[model samples]
Target: MFGKILIANRGEIVCRVIRTARKLGVRTVAVYSDADVRALHVEMADEAVHIGPSPVGESYLRGDRIIAAALATSAQAIHPGYGFLSENPDFVDQVTAAGLVFIGPSAASIRAMGLKDAAKRLMEKAGVPVVPGYHGEAQEIVLLASKAREVGYPVLIKARAGGGGKGMRRVDHPDDFSEALSGARREAKAAFGDDRVLVEKYVDKPRHIEVQVFGDNFGNAVHLYERDCSAQRRHQKVIEEVPAPGMTPALRKAMTEAAVKAAKAINYSGAGTIEFIADASGGLKPDRFWFMEMNTRLQVEHPVTEMVTGVDLVEWQLRVASGEKLPKTQGEIALAGHAFEARIYAEDAAKGFLPATGMLHHLQFPDAPPQGAAMRIETGVRAGDAISPFYDPMIAKLVVHAKDRTTALGALHDALARTEVAGSTVNMAFLAALAADADFAAGDVDTGLIGRHQDALVAVAAPSDEAIAAAALAATDAGAPGRAADPWSSLAGYAHFHTLARRTRLRFGEENILARVSARPDGRFQVALEAPHDAINSHDLRNLLRTARWPGHVTVFEGAVGYTFAVPDPLAKADEAAAATGSLRAPMPGLVKLVRAAAGDAVIKGQPLLILEAMKMEHTIAAPHDGVIAEIATEGAQVSDGTVLVRFEDGQG
Candidate 1:
């Protein structure tokens, strides 16, 4: 193995590479941008280098700067961890020209499968099955529309040069094809600098299964089995598992063979993934799957494969790049157990999975996984780190393995329920629901599972009465349960000193809550909470929700949703009750892409008011009710979360 290597990436992936490098007694060099100055990855590296500004274009994507840093640090190789410059063939060539190894597939292999259209044609030539679509070079809009008509209705318009959901759209009718094509092209140009696209028939029921394969300089290749990534949203993988539930021996053999062929076709070196889109309308069959695309780098879901195969893929990458033969043949590798991986992101699944940015005031997980149990949390941020808008908003990857699929899934569900995050909105509740869903638990999943069951899965728990009482108690004394911070009792209220109940006022959003607490005879406190349109519900003193407090703030977690409440100051102005006003606020920090509605324009509920772009996704802010827009924000302004973008006319609140 080499003495040192530089990781040309950030976030959890950087930290992930370091762990394996340390295991092999190799030092790691980390590159960071302005936003990641205090990032966890920077602190974990043996040596660190500052790149550029926070935006990826200015920092992580600067291949020349990264190469120079590696050369200066005497790194023998550069590891581009799965994103940014990882798939860029030009970067690989640049690294090689600078006398350094790129710890991934060769430049020739990456160029062979860089674009969707070209890769599809190449796969066909290599005798690998590919989806029937228009993979030609005709870029005329009318020609593309005509081809979509030929393919059939409900065709998919995908950017030819990039992955992820950035430049992909699904059109069900001919009338929407033109507009969808335009939008896809715009995003494609913005993301990949290539607006060219291709059309494909949309599979009604599809299961995304991909094979993990590795190659070495000696012309030997092997497969490490397949992973099922059917759980997705907008073309992004959410949950992944190994030994796909309904997979037969014949199906696995066919898939793995085709994957190996695809890898060796380009003389691929190092790690790569061959993704296939399977027709699951009937069932998984030998001929029902076709190559979707090839990820020429280690994937985000690689941990599940490691858990079952008992192999460290990173170590393999280092060894292969250092002129070693294949570590194992196909016959030597075998599956041991079932494994699952769920991506935890700082986003609100209820709001179309819109990404959020904030400080992680309180972040805690269950105790580290036992040695053999293998419940792992792969993360790059600690309790005080912030999730900024400068990069991907993923928080962590939760991995678990067990004797079988059923047991592993059960452990995943329990682990999700135990995760606690207080500062930003997260998708833990949705993940828990998906893990516990009947169809998923039975291994009956498809790409449309999340879209079909989104309403039920994203219904995060609302703060219960007990949660409010717990918040009230946390905000006042700010002490652990069964202990009081001061000698003053709840009975010491009013001018008289005999005995009286204390009323504490708190605010959660527009709702005002009053908690009446009285000290019991046994040195205990009982709380009765009163809210709008409800009786004075008595809270069970014996049971209080888990809470975390910081000075004047309190957050009570209710099944992964943190409900933060603040105690109002008696001397402050009483603005909490001044409601009935109209204001449209930005849900997260973003740039205002477009202003669909103008001032004085009348709009109804759910009508598009403006469009905001954040974290590379577009979010449309709609009117809340029938009202006339009296004021509006600029179309090109960048604003933070909760910034008022529009205000309705008087009495329209």
Candidate 2:
């Protein structure tokens, strides 16, 4: 094994690599950008180096800077963890040219699988089944449209160089093909710097199943089973599981063989994943699956595979990169228990899963599962860390293992419920709801599961009366003189011979609650619910309050959800003027990528008005109703959250 290695990445994956390197007694170096000076991964590394500014182009994407940092730190090899430079073929060549071992596949392997169109063609020649699509190089709009028609309606236009759902679109009709192609090309160019695309037939009821494959420079390769990544949102996997539900032994064998074949065909080295889009319409079958793409590095959901196979994939990567033979043959690896990994992200699940930025005031995960239960939480951010907009908003990956799929899923639900977070919008509630979903529990999942059940999954419930009372009590300072020095003075009611009583008003979302409290003889206060008119002990309410106050807001976690309440200031004006006439505000902070409607242009309801790109995703703002656009935000403008982007006439004229 190498004595020291440089992790050429950031966030959880960097920390993940550091953990394994430490176990192997390998010294590790971490590279960071301007925005990550205080990042968790930096603190965990044996040595740290500053690369460049926060913008990826100037920092993480700069292969030269990363190589210099590794050479300066005397790192024997460089581990490109997952994103950033992990899949960049040119970076691999650069690292090799620098005389440092790249702890991953060779440049040839990456190039062989980098472009989707070319990779598909390669797979077909290698006798691996590939989706029926036009992988040709013709980029003319008319030709592409004709190909889509040939492939039948509902064709998928995917950027040849795209991943993470970027630069991809689904067109269900011929009329929408032109627009979809243009948008896909633009996004592809912006994201991958490649405008080339491929048209593919969209499978009905598609299920994403990918096999974990590993290879050594000695020409040996093996498969570590498969992961079902069908639970997706916006074409990105949200939850991944090993030993796919309803998977038959025969089918598993065939898929694994095909995956191993694909890896060997490329002379693949280290860890890689061969993703397949299986036709679930007729259930999983050996002949019903087609190659999608190969992730040429360790995957974000590798933990589940590790849990089921009882292998440390990173350790294997290190061993293989050190010129060791394959750790185990295909027959040596055996599937153990079922496992599930839920990606916890710092985003508002109810608001289109919009990426959020804030300081993490409080964070906690469920305690380790019982001695025999396998549970893991992988994260790079702590309670006080900030979720910046410069990187992916992923908070952590929650993994659990059990005897069977049902039991493992049950464990997943409990784990999500026990997870706690505050000071930022999160998808915890949505995850919990998903775990409890009957269809999900029964293993009836696909890429469209989230969209099919979005209403229930994203629905936000109002805080209960008890929850509101708890928030109110938490917001009130425990050190206040009224409550600490004289409990009676804090009461909400008082009479000649009765306890004093006080009513406190609190707001949760758009609903307000009046909590009546009175001092009791036992030093505890009694709370009365207004709507339900139920009397409850204040001690009970206080016990349920898990809160943290920051500046002008208090966040309380209750019923597996975190609710933030703003402490109203009496000095502030209540009736602030509404937004200036017909103004449409930007929903979040982002760069105005495109202005679709010009000033004085008439638009109908739901018409695309402008596109705002934030956190590496594009969001289109649409007209609320029929109206003439009076003004529009300039293209390429940087707008803050809630900044008016456009104004419309009072009525169409």
Candidate 3:
């Protein structure tokens, strides 16, 4: 085994690689950009190297800087974890020319699968089943439109070099094909610097099923069963599971063999995934599955496969890169039980799942299942860390396993319900709701599951009366420094000769609530809700506040939800409210990518006025209503949240 390896990545994947390297007694080196100077992975590695600035192009994507860092640290190998330079074929060649091992497939294999159109052609030539589509090299718009018509309406316009749903669009008719193609090409160029695209027939009720395949230097390869990544949003996976819930023995056998064959076709080495899109309109069938694409590196959801097969994928990567033979033959590998992985992202599900950034003042997870229990959390952030806009907003991956799918899914729900996060908005509530979703629990999932049930899934439930009272009590307790020692000193509106009820006013969102508190003779406090419909009686405040912290603001986690409440100062409410009107504000800090309208341009409601790119995703700022634009921010300008992007004329509607 190599004595040391450099992890050319950041976030959880970097930490993940380091963990396995440490377990094998291999020293690990980590490379970081300016934004990740204090990142968790940097703190965990045996050695760290500074590459460049915060922007990925200046740092993470700088293959030269990464190679130099590895050479300086004497790293015998470099592990490109999942993203950044992981699948870049040129980067792989650079690493190999530097006389260091690249702990993944060869550059040739990556090139074979890098472009979607070319990869599909290769798969077809290799006798691997492929979807019916246009995989030709022609790029003319008219030719592409004709191909879409040939494939029938509802064709998919996809960037040949895209992943993560960045440059993909589904056109339902010929009327929309031109616009869809233009948008897909633009996004593809912006994201991957490649404007080439392919048109494919859209599969109805599709299920995303991928097989984890590994190969070694000796031409030996094996499959690690499969993961069902059908639950997706915006074409990106949300939840994944191993030993697909409805998979049959015959179907699993056929798909696994096909995946292994695809791997062998490329003479693939190290860890890679062969993703297949199954036509689920008639349920999973041997002949209904077709090759989608092959990811030429470790996958984000590999843990689900690991949990079911009891194999260390990263360890296999290291061993294979070291020229070792396959760890185990295909016959020796076995699937034990069911496992599920839910990607926890720092995003607001209600707000179109836009990525969010903030300090993590509080973060907690349920205790891992006792020793052998099938539960694990893979994360790179801790309390006090910040989720910046410079990188992916993933918070963590929650994996759970059990003897059966039902049991494992139940555990998933319980785990999500027990997780807590504060100091920023998160999709925890949405995740919990999804775990408990009847259709999801029943395993009737597809790419459109979230969209079909979006209203309920993204609905933010108002905090209960008990929860509000708990927050009030916690807030008052936080304001009193001597409450722990002298309970009476914490009392508000208390008299020397007479007893009176004390009320605390608090603001949660836009509603203000009055909480009445009284000191009981038994030394317990009773909190009553006085607004938003009064509670009939007071409830004892003993354990309602599971965890409370006051750092500039009050945050309390009660009943599996974290609520941040601000005390009304009666001083700045008017100013704050007045500053938030008659303008389009940037929802989050980001770079202005495009300003669609000039000052004084007349626009209709919902008209696209500008585009803001943040966290690597484009968001359109639309005109709130029919109005004349009075002012607009310039394109290419960096703006903070609440910075006015456009202001409308008064009564313009």
Candidate 4:
């Protein structure tokens, strides 16, 4: 094995590679940009090198800088952890040209499988079932429309060079084809620098099943069963599992064989994944699966596969890259217990799952597992780390394993419920809802499940009265003079005969919750809430008063309410404002990639006026009302949160 290798990536994946390399006694060198000087991966590596500025184009995407860092560090090989330069064929060639081993597939193999159109054609020739689509080079808009009509409506237009769901559009009718094509082309060009696209028939119920394939220099290859990645949002996978639910033995065998064939046909080596779009309209069958695309590097959800198969894929990658044959043959490999991976991202589910950026004030995963069993929490960020706008906003990969799929799902649900995060919005509640969904429980899922039940999926969980009281109690500052010096001064904890009453309101959704608290002679308190629906909930806060987080916004315990007291200084209250009347803008840092309207330009309500590219995705800024653009702020520039992109004139005819 190589003594030292450079990890040409960042974030959790870089941290992931470093962990494996450390176990194998291989030294790791981490490359970071300006924004990542204090990143977790940098701290985790044996050595670190500063590459360039904050923007990816200025650093991570610069192959020359990465190669120089590796050579300077005397690294023997470079592991292009998935994303950035992972699938870039030219970068692979450059690494090998420098006489350094590239710890992934060869340039030839990446070229063969990088482009969707070309890879689909290759899969078809290799007898691996491929979806019926037009993989032609015809760029004529009219011709593309005709092909969509030929294939039928509800077709998928995918960028030939795209991954991670960018540059993909689903056309439901001929009229929408032109707009989708234009949007897909623009996004593809921006994301992959490849505007070429391929049209494919959209499966009614698509279940993303991908086979994990490994190959060696000795021309031997094997499949590590499959992972069901059907739980997705915005075409991005949210949850994945190994030993797909409802998978038959016969079907698994066929997929494994086909996956091996696909690997050998391309002379594919190292760790890769052959993603198949399975037709779920009919139950999973050997014949209903078709090749979608192949990921030419280690996948983000590889942990689930590792957990179930008892195989460390990273170890295999190191071994194979060192010219060793795979340890096991196809017949030798065996399936084991089920495993699941839920991708915890720093995103706002209520805001359309838009990637969010914030300093992690408090981040805690369950330290004590139920029954004291092992659980895996793979993350690269620590408390006080900021989720930068330069890369993916994924917080961590939470993986769980059990004897059966049902048990695994149950464990995952419990884990999510116990997970706690503060200081920023996240999708934890949404993930919990997904775990509890009946369809997911029954192993029935599709790409559109999230879109179907979005309202219920992203709903903020209701905190019981007891829970609220607990939160209030947790929020109470024990150090306060009023609470410490006089227990009766604290609401719901009066030691005197006549109890004091206190009122507090909390924000839930767009509404405020009015709650009244009454102190008891004992340490406990009673909370009464009057809601808009004329509903009243009287909660007991005995346990909450004794055990609650210190100075919290709110807390829920069982079905009861808890209230903590933090009597803010009147001086501080005078200095705080409830609302701002200034213009609203992007909430996080980002680059202003597009300016849709000029100053004095008339715009209607909800009209798109600008686009900000942050966290590897584009977000549009819309007009608040029908008005002329009064001011356009900082076009084509990097901006922090609340940096206005466009301002509207006051109401006037």
Candidate 5:
């Protein structure tokens, strides 16, 4: 291994690479943008270099700046840790031309697998099974629509140049094909700078299974098994696991052998993943699976693979990049136990999973195992870090392992329940529900599973009386005089030699509730909430919930959901007047992609209004009711959460 190397990425992947580089006695250099000057990876690296501004195009994607930083630091190689420049073949060539080793596949291999259409063609030539689709170069809308027809209804239109669920659309009918094609083209162009796309047959009950394949300079490759990534929302993987449920020895043999074949065909090197889309209508079979695309670098769900194989994949990457042969042969790698990974993102499941941004006032993970540390928490932001809009809003990944699939699923559920976060909305409760879902427990997974069960999964329960009591206690300085155990803590209750009580107001969701609290003589407290729900007597609320309090907010975590409340200021003035009706607000911070209406245009309820692109996803703002347009936000404008995007006329005229 080299003495030093630079990680050409940011966030969790960069931090992940640093951990392994340290173990190999490799001094690592980290590159950061203005927004990440204080990122965790920068602090953990041996040396750090400032790249550029916050936006990716200005910072992380600047290959020249990254290469200069590496050369200046006297680094021997550059590790493109999976996002920005990892799959860019031109960047690989540039790095090689700069007299530095690119710690990944060669430019030739990346080009071979870069474009989905081209790669599918190559796979077909190599005798690998590929999905039936239109991988043609014709970009005309008329031609593409005909291809979609040929492929059948419910076809999947995917951008040939990129992955990660971006630039992808599913058309279920011919009438919607035109609109879907335009939208997919625009999104693809914005995301990948490529408007070209491919149409594929959408499999019924499709399951996403990808194999982890590694190769080295000596033309040797090995398979570390496969991961089931079918648990998805918006075409993104939410949960991943190894030794896919319901996998038979014969089927595993067929898939793994095919994966190895794909890797060798490309002369792949270092870490890579071969993703396949399988038709599970008749359960997993050798021929039911077809090639999806190849991820030419490390994946976000790689930890689950590491847990079962007892191999450090990063160490292997280093060894292979340093011109070493494959560490373990095909037979040496053996699956031991089951593992699960739940991606914890900073987003609201209730509001259609829109990305959220806020400070992480408090963050905590479950304790690792006492011996082998089976439970792993991979995170880049700490308690005080902020989840900004410039990057992916994933907070961390919760991984767990056990002797069996059932036990591992249970462990994952328990871990999610114990996880705590504050100052930002999250999807932990949704993840817990998914882990406990009957279908998931029985290994019945598919690409559309979330969409089918979203209503039940995203249904959030009202905060319990105990949770409200805890929030009330934390919102108000109930133990202001002293700790609850202190004798003088109850002095607020004894005014004029009589028991006294004070009322406090707290905001739960959209309504404010008045809660009455009184100190007990036994150094405890009693809370009574005045709301629509029945009231319950408080009893030792301190031991019932975990809370984190800020200046104007109190977050109470229970049942895997965080109930955050706004503690009104005593002296602050209230709003003078409520806003008028017929207003549509931006659900989250995003750029206004297009405004579908101008002032005075009449529209019916649920009509197309505006499209806001946030967190790399486009959300169409629709008219709430039949009304005439009054004012609308300008297109290409960046709006924040709750910013009024469009306003309707005073009355439906």
Candidate 6:
């Protein structure tokens, strides 16, 4: 094995590579952007180098800078971990040209499968079952529409050059085809710099099952079973499992063989996944699946596959890249157990699952897996790290394994319920909801599972009456009566020995929790809370505040959501009334891409105003109501959250 290698990536994947490399006695050189100067990956590597600015285009994607860093650090090879330059064939070629090994598939192999349309044609020739679609090189929009018509309704227009759900649009009717194609082409150009697309017949109720395959330089390849990635949101997988639910032994054998065949066709080396879209209505069958795409690198959910296969794919990547054959043949590989992986992302599930960014003030997970369970965590960040906007918003991959699919799912559900994270919004509750979902538990899942049960997925437990009372009382700075901080309880009223009854209502979602609090003999307040149904649950505020321990703030973590109550010193509210209020705010911090309406333009509800790009996605803000635009502040400018872009007469709030 080589003495050192460079990890040409960032976030959790970079950290993942570094760990495996270190275990194999290979020192890792990490390349970071300006935003990641003190990131977890940088701190964990043997050596680190600054590539460029925070933006991926300026840093991680700069092949020349990455190559220079690798050479300067004397790295013998470079591992591009699944994104940025991972599938860039030109970058792979450049790395080999510089006398450094690219720890992935050969550049020729990548080029063969880089474009979706071309790859499908190649698969068909390789005897692998491919989706029935138009893979032809027709550029005319009318011709493409005709092909879609030929393929039947509900055709999928997908970018030929990129993945990660970008530049992909599903049109269910001919009337929506033109507008969707335009949007898909625009996004494809922006993301992959390629406007070329392919039209495919959209498979209804498809289950995403992908096989993990490995090969050596000697043309030997073996498959490591399959992973069911059917639990998805916005076309991106949120949950994945190995030894796919409802998979039959015959189906598994066929998919594995097909995956190995696809690998052999490309002379594929190292770790690659051949993803298949299967019709799961009748359960997995040998003849019911078709090739979707191939991920040319280690997948994010590889841990789940590792748990069931007893294989360390990263170690295999290193061995294959170093001219060694795969450790095992297809006959020797066997699935051991069932495994599940849930992607914990810093995102708001209710607001369309928009990515969130914040400091991780408090992050905690179960110290050990449940008895007889294999709970694994693969993360690049720790407490005190900031979730930056310049990268993917995933916090970690939580994997669980057990003797059976049912047991593994049960363990995953319990694990999610016990996991706690503060200071930032997360999809933990949503993930728990998904695990407990009836269809999901029954292995009846599809791409539309989350969309169909979206409301229940985002339903948070309402704070109980006692919890709300405790939060209100905790918000008051006075300590409990007879405690050190509440010694002046008898003199609270000043004129006489009296108690002040403070009433405060906290709003979460659409429910209002009412609290009536009074200071006791000690500084602590005796609080009583009432819910809408006259249900009362009393909470002792003493322990809740102490356990949360936020800096100058009290956050009551009860039920499903956290309630943030300020412990102000009575003067903080006076300072809030003096601020100006006419600013039209940006809902998120992002770069202003376009300004549709100028000043004084009449705008109606749902009228597009401007576009903002964040976390590799574009969002357009619209007018909340029918109003006349009074001022247009910024156009094509980078702005922070709540930065004003335009102002309207009655929509200022």
Best by TM-score: 5
The worst-scoring run of ten residues by lDDT in candidate 4 lies at 557-566
RMSD of each: 2.9, 2.8, 2.3, 4.0, 1.9, 3.6
TM-scores of all models? 0.93, 0.94, 0.95, 0.89, 0.97, 0.90
Report lDDT (Cα) of residue 390, candidate 5.
93
Error in Å for residue 139 of model 1: 1.5
Which candidate, 1 or 5, has the higher lDDT?
A: 5
* Clashing residue pair totals per candidate (backbone < 3 A): 0, 7, 0, 24, 0, 10
Query: Candidate 6 lDDT, tens digit per residue, 180-206?
Result: 897788778878999999999898888
Candidate order by decreasing lDDT: 5, 1, 2, 3, 6, 4
Candidates ranked, most accurate by TM-score first = 5, 3, 2, 1, 6, 4
After the best TM-score superposition of candidate 1, give how far the Cα of residue 348 lies from its true spot, in angstroms.
1.2
Show model 3 residue runs off by greater than 4 Å. Answer: 370-372, 478-493, 499-503, 535-545, 558-560, 569-580, 651-653
Candidate 3, 408-473: lDDT as tens digits: 887887787678888778888888788789988888888878999999998867776666766766
Per-residue lDDT for 270-360 in model 1, tens only?
A: 9999999998999999999999899999999999999999999999999999889888888999999999999999988988999889888
Better of 4 and 5 by lDDT: 5
Candidate with best lDDT: 5
The list of candidate 5 runs beyond 4 A from truth reads 369-373, 479-482, 531-537, 540-544, 575-580, 651-653
- Candidate 5, residue 107: Cα displacement in angstroms equals 0.6
lDDT of each: 0.87, 0.86, 0.85, 0.80, 0.88, 0.81
For model 2, name the residue pairs that clash: 491-501, 491-502, 492-501, 492-502, 493-500, 493-501, 493-502
Q: Indicate the worst ten consecutive residues by lDDT in candidate 6.
A: 533-542
lDDT of 4: 0.80
Q: How many backbone clashes does candidate 5 have?
A: 0
Candidate 6 lands at a TM-score of 0.90
